[model samples]
Target chain A: MSIQIWTFILVGITFAIYLSIAWMSRVRDTRGFYVAGGGVPALANGMATAADWMSAASFISMAGLISFMGYTGCVYLMGWTGGYVLLALLLAPYLRKFGKFTVPDFVGDRYYSDGARVVALVCAIFASLTYVAGQMRGVGIVFSRFLEVDVNTGVIIGMIIVFIYAGLGGMKGITWTQVAQYCVLILAFLIPAVAISIKITGHFIPQIGFGGVISEGANAGRYLLDTLNAISADLGFDQYTQAFGPNSKSMLDVAAITLALMVGTAGLPHVIIRFYTVPSVKAARLSAGYALLFIAILYTTAPSVAVFARYNMIDTLNNVAYEQAPSWFKNWEKTGLIAWVDKNGDGKMEYRAGKAIEGKPKLTGQTGIYGQALVSNKVVDSNANELYVDRDIMVLANPEIADLPAWVIALVAAGGLAAALSTASGLLLVIASSISHDLYYRIINRSASEKQRLLLGRIMIGVAVCAAGYFGINPPGFVAQVVAFAFGLAASSFFPILVLGIFWKRASKEGAITGMVLGIGFTMLYIIQTKFLGVGNWFFGISPEGIGTVGMILNFAATVLVSLVTKAPPQDIQDMVESIRTPRGAGLATDH
Target chain B: MENQDRLKEYWRRNLRLMLVLLAIWAVVSYGFSIVFVQALNKIHLGGFPLGFWFAQQGSIYTFVGLIFVYVWRMRRLDREYDVHE
Candidate 1:
């Protein structure tokens, strides 16, 4: 079968399974809609959490980023996985014990103030929207490339499918569908990795193959990292297998970025809410462990994939004659993602370092200025023979680059779609619950009936989906960049407040509110100035990605300073904190 | 008075365990991977530089192990304090 037909068949089958699950598990009450009735089993909830956590960034863009950035990319791998440790030990079980329907529930009740709840609601909605926009864009990219449709049409199709499952089934439906998504995405990620590993190192395991010596090729008997390092040096890039020091990304920047990602993962309302779906506090703790184990399966494999994909691209394209290029090269070129200019009129492509030459001859009525076959539109640079290859193509084009079979490429398309859809549904649920449960039921209509709240939740999901789809069509940045901003905002605004509310009994409503406002305010201002305004030189040499760590520090300082001056929380609130610290009476949501 | 002391003791032990485990997490991810990375790079493990392996692969495996260890110890602690859920 053709690759396009196979993609359609696999994607169609997966969508059908998701829709059926959504139909069967249709939510009946506010509890089901908001928290999946708080009855999801540990293993199943673990799978759901893994799916919810690994968004399009993890599935599609992470390996690509790692391939280009090399060792500096370790910040993402360590930061993301390490956060689960904090969640399992410091946050998850405690939140499950204090559980209501949403993150705001804890903030509101713990501080004994509706003011704090509103702050948390706003943060949750803001962070989740930023994250979900990236997921929607990812879905559109996969659809447009594989299904041969325009980007907007592809986005609309994805929005419709997510609306069906998320709007109808709520958390209950989303949970089951996520379990299926985890299976598809993991298999899709692994098959290519394993195949390439065996091809390179004669090993079945990618982890071992990463460090094994290549058994064939010109680099035979040479260690994989040794070969990659030599190739990178020849291309004027840093070694692929060494840590960044004074010459590259600073140690402080690495430390700051890693910390920000860890805290941000713990703070994300969508991921934290996954813990509330489990039946018991013990299950919440155990489920985090299971979730990490599941997430690790992919996290560990990504670096290997990055190394192999980098090697393949360099090996195939370096110094090759333009006319002798492979079919895959031409296919990617038509999409405008790969461009080359024969500056010396040598009729050969040069893949090297430094800036491409500028202002070459136009291709209107001219021929043979460079080559008879090469046109101006195909060559972006005129003066120098430079090749521009987009980093995002690394993973999507990996199978073809390795000459893997067509069916494997089709499976990758399905996997990318599954990843984006599952995460989009999860984030939309958080946004919907924050509006319907926190803003509407709790504050606006304190006496709203269960049916009214359920109806409102569904309505909010529809509206949120439309907004996310619009952003996907006009994405502000790349998939991983937008996600990094989401993480930064979440780390700054929610993480410090949540930690203080539980761990410090004297934390007051005034302090929490002040802390959240200042934290989010500072982080947003930094991101806007640097990202959109093109401002150079961040404060203290920290990148915008690591500025959230500074914001978090300011938040903690503000909270602590404010709380010391203010009166302590009420006796009941203090006692509530004490009870949440223990594991007893955790399954039931009671206020003692 | 006796019940209050037992509850206090349980909470204290839990906090102590958390402190100890979190310390390990920090040392592996931040300390080995970043702060001491240059020093560790002098040593090679298989085909990987020691610090590079810790940053990219070893830290993740340690995180997974840390979580399971926390769960197992917490379960036993809960039972000892009659707080098992």
Candidate 2:
């Protein structure tokens, strides 16, 4: 009857489904292991791509981030979704025609250089590892809350689950599991959002309800955005719909960040790899459309959920005594992610614009006078703010804040796990494939048998999972910063080269290798300088988050310039480029 | 030689179509959503400010539409060039 029980039931059921799919789909050959025999339906591949693309960040974090950020959060919404257009138009279909097992395969063959293949795979591994670490942490957070386990134990459990499917079935297993995950995660996101929408605005459609007038609140009869704007301003925060507010990002930064993410999304190895599962060039194009449509359902609803979460947070928390606070607040507080300091000694929590405590909540593992979590953080001398809620709590605690059913809360837990686990397996598969397929077989053993390749692939997955799990528990200082730059890295590293390889016939091995090294190098150096050395915003006032666009530009320039000066590619290679331009004669994903 | 010319013409048409679509993509996302957001926010679409809606919702819808459109047009282009699989 309780939320915890419901979480166990839902998560147990979903995990059973995933493990069974993995068992049934296990493959013996390198082609089937890597590309699911290149026979997945467009509709199914679309669902898998949706699940793969929307990681822990999209499911658990984006809505909360948007809640805190207001309109400027558009950088993520547009940046992430817009990349599918580039993928559908410029990348996916042609790559499908090239018909290889990995992005590195295309790079190696097209550029006619093993060096280019190694460079691209290295970038792919680096970016994916950073992204997977974030997912493992998301899994840890969900399990820590619902299963009552420690974060490290939750990560170990997640690593084991991912290893089973990814190690055994490889891409064949991951694709099917992701399809199920897409369904579970999307439903989990929508049910709470739709219910909260109906409660507040009496509108079932969240997007339209977002504009509907509040139904039964103090701000009743006023439009939802207007009401949120009033609440935000009254709390000394910017208006809810305030575009480019003073506390928010500048216009150029928003644009640059969006461009980086869009380009980066298309370039991400895991996402592009999903196209290989499908049957044809046309399926690849159509699947991208379906992927975006499915992704849009969650993306559009996120902003609406952001509004409702902020509105409900203010309605339930501010001015309520700590003992009188909603049960969810008390429960979340035990996790130490949500804390309150009674600045005025009134025993009440006040949600305001300024910091509630210095630095972050330092839990003393003891209860305060009012039974609130006792944190050692010094109360800020500046303001009356008394709440220090982690932004992540916005989505997880939304149902509880609005008094939704326990089943929905449990569904949220399962959904978050589904999101985190699905993407982690996808990334792990890529890492394993890079080693077994690219590094070992292609580079080291051209005569390796299918059995040997499959064995190596399965073994590398276990290693990747352990490495990812360790990083999840002891996340590096750069975990959050590196994620943004991972996108920049992908943008700088892969997008330009892949596009040039397809569209430009003259692109040589020398040109691709040089562009890849310099472009990725420039982006990496900028990220390190700004993120690590604290040298902030040196290039045209763009921060590390937006520097990928500059890196991409440099890559395009370098590739084109170098290619023009160098000898043209061989005549046969030129004809190969011309041949891939047509959609006919698509091959199953395999090496020659 | 004739086949080469047809291939060139097909590639040219594809490039031309892509240019048009990408231009729309840039205009909506960069031009309206980012650069001219403030000006557009003065206009409202239902409950959402026009630019904010584009940033949050409209651009995503347009992206989905653009992809399907490309699929349909490209499929036809393939047929026209006798290149359909």
Candidate 3:
């Protein structure tokens, strides 16, 4: 069957499964709606957390990033999965013990300050919304390519589906839905890796295949890394396996970034909420262990995919004539996802980095441009600017370039959609919960009935869906770029406060408020200045890496200094901290 | 009185264990991969660079191993503390 038809069938099957799961597990009350009656199994909850954690970026962009970046791409793999260890060990169990409905609830009550809760609430919503916008865009991209629809229409459709499910079922529905999503996304990622491994190395396991030297015809035992590094250097890029940037980042910077991500991942409200679904504190802890295991499956395989794709691309096209390029090349070319132009009119695509050559125009009444129709419908200026390097193209173009069957290609399309939708649903539930449970019932209308709260939750979801759709339609910025901002904000604001509130008995309301504000505020000021004001050099030499680290350091310093300046919290708040720390109080709420 | 002694002993022991395991986790991940990668690159494992191994696989294996150990030891500690379900 054609790839399009197969994509339809696979996507159809996935949607049917989600709708069925959502239908069967409808929420009954506010408690059930918010936390699934707090009775989900630990292992199942872990799997769902994995699904929620691995968003569209993980499935679609991460491997693709590694494909071109080679060894340096290890940063994403190590940073992301390593963060989970920090989460499971340090944060999840204590938060579960806190027994709160939302992250803000923990902060507000722990500090005995509504102001602190509002700060956390602002941070959570900002992080969640930025993350959700990226997912919406991811869904739209996959749907546009596979389902043959406009990107915006696909976005609206995805938003509607999430609205119906997340609005109706809340966290209960989201957890089960995420489990299904994890299965589909993992299968989709692994199948291609396995197929390509067998094709290239005569092995099924990608990691083993990666180490096994290339066994294909005419390239037997070729070292992939050596070949890729040579190709990259040929194209005016850094050697693929070697680090190219500044040879020095302070140990402090490294520690700060790692700590920020580690704390940030654990601090993410969407991820923390998953633990609340489990039955007991022990289960909550165990669930985090399981989530890491599931995430590890993808984390380990991703580097192999990156290395293999890089080696294969260089080998397949080296010195080959342009007109005879594979169908996948032409297909991606049409989408403007990948582009190449022949210089010197040599009837061959020269994939190299060199200075521009002035030449005649290809099509013009009067022109003096380096222009020629060098290959089949491919034009080149005598002086091409540079090779196009959009990172999103890597995964979508992987299957076709590797000559995989139409079915695998279709499955990948569905997989990307699954990753996007699953995470979006999880976030939407949080957004719904924040409104229905925290804002409306707790703050705004304390006496509102459960039925009214549920209705309000659904209404809030509709509003959230519309907002997400608008961003997806006109994506404000880069997918990976926007995601980093969310992480930065979270790392700065929520992580420090949460850690202090849980671990330090003396952390007062003033300390929590000051830390969160400085963390988020400093990071925002740096980002705004760097991106808009173009005065990146002016701000403590702050680039993306430096800004997050600086923000985190400032957060720590402010919290400590402010806490020392302010009086220790009241007797009851001090007791609350002690109770949360003790294992005996596991069944009771922190305040009680 | 015996139970109280056992619980205090358990908390003291578990705290020590958690600190040790956390050290190992930090060393393998941040220490090896970020701080000491260049130094460790002089040593190789199975023809693969040691630093690359830690970045890609070794660190993850360490994390998983640490968690399982934590769970197993924590379960034992819970029994000692009379906190086991």
Interface RMSD of each: 0.9, 0.9, 2.4
The residue-by-residue lDDT of candidate 1 on B1-85, one tens digit each, is: 9977888899889889999999999999998888888788889998888888898899999999999999999999999999887
| Interface quality of candidate 3 as DockQ | 0.48
Q: For residues B1-85, could you state the per-residue lDDT of candidate 3 as single tens digits?
A: 8965765576568668878988998899887876776677667564356776676778887887788777777777776677765
Q: TM-score for the first chain of model 1? A: 0.94
* A487 Cα displacement, candidate 1 (Å): 1.3
Per-residue lDDT of candidate 2, residues A385-477 (tens digit): 899978888888888876888999999999999999989999998888898898898899999988888898999999999999999999997
Task: Score candidate 3 by TM-score against the native.
Answer: 0.91
Backbone clash pairs for candidate 2 read: none
The residue ranges of model 1 lying beyond 4 angstroms of the native Cα positions read A245-247, A355-385, A477-482, A588-592
Residue B68 in candidate 2 has what lDDT?
Answer: 93
TM-score per prediction, in order, is 0.95, 0.98, 0.91
Index of the highest-lDDT prediction: 2
Best by TM-score: 2
Candidate 3 lDDT, A489-532, residue by residue in tens: 87788777777887787999999899989888888887777666
> Residue by residue across A1-592, what tens digits does model 1's lDDT show?
8889999999999999999999999999888888898999999999999999998889998988898778899999998899999999989999998878889889889878999999899989988998899889889989988889998888999999999999999999999999999999999999988888888887889988888888887888998888998988777777786677334677788888899999999999999999989989899999999999999999999999998887777777777877677777777765555666666667777776554433432334333433333335544443343676666677788777767888888989999999999999999999998998889888888888888888999999999999899999998645456665788888998899889988899888888888888988898888778877889737877788888898899888899889999999999998888888887877644222
- The segments of candidate 3 whose C-alpha lies over 4 angstroms from its true place after superposition are A244-259, A353-389, A478-480, A537-542, A588-592, B1-14
Model 1 chain A poorest ten-residue lDDT run: A357-366
Model 3: residue A285 alpha-carbon error in angstroms: 1.1
For each candidate in the order shown, give its overall lDDT on alpha carbons.
0.86, 0.90, 0.74
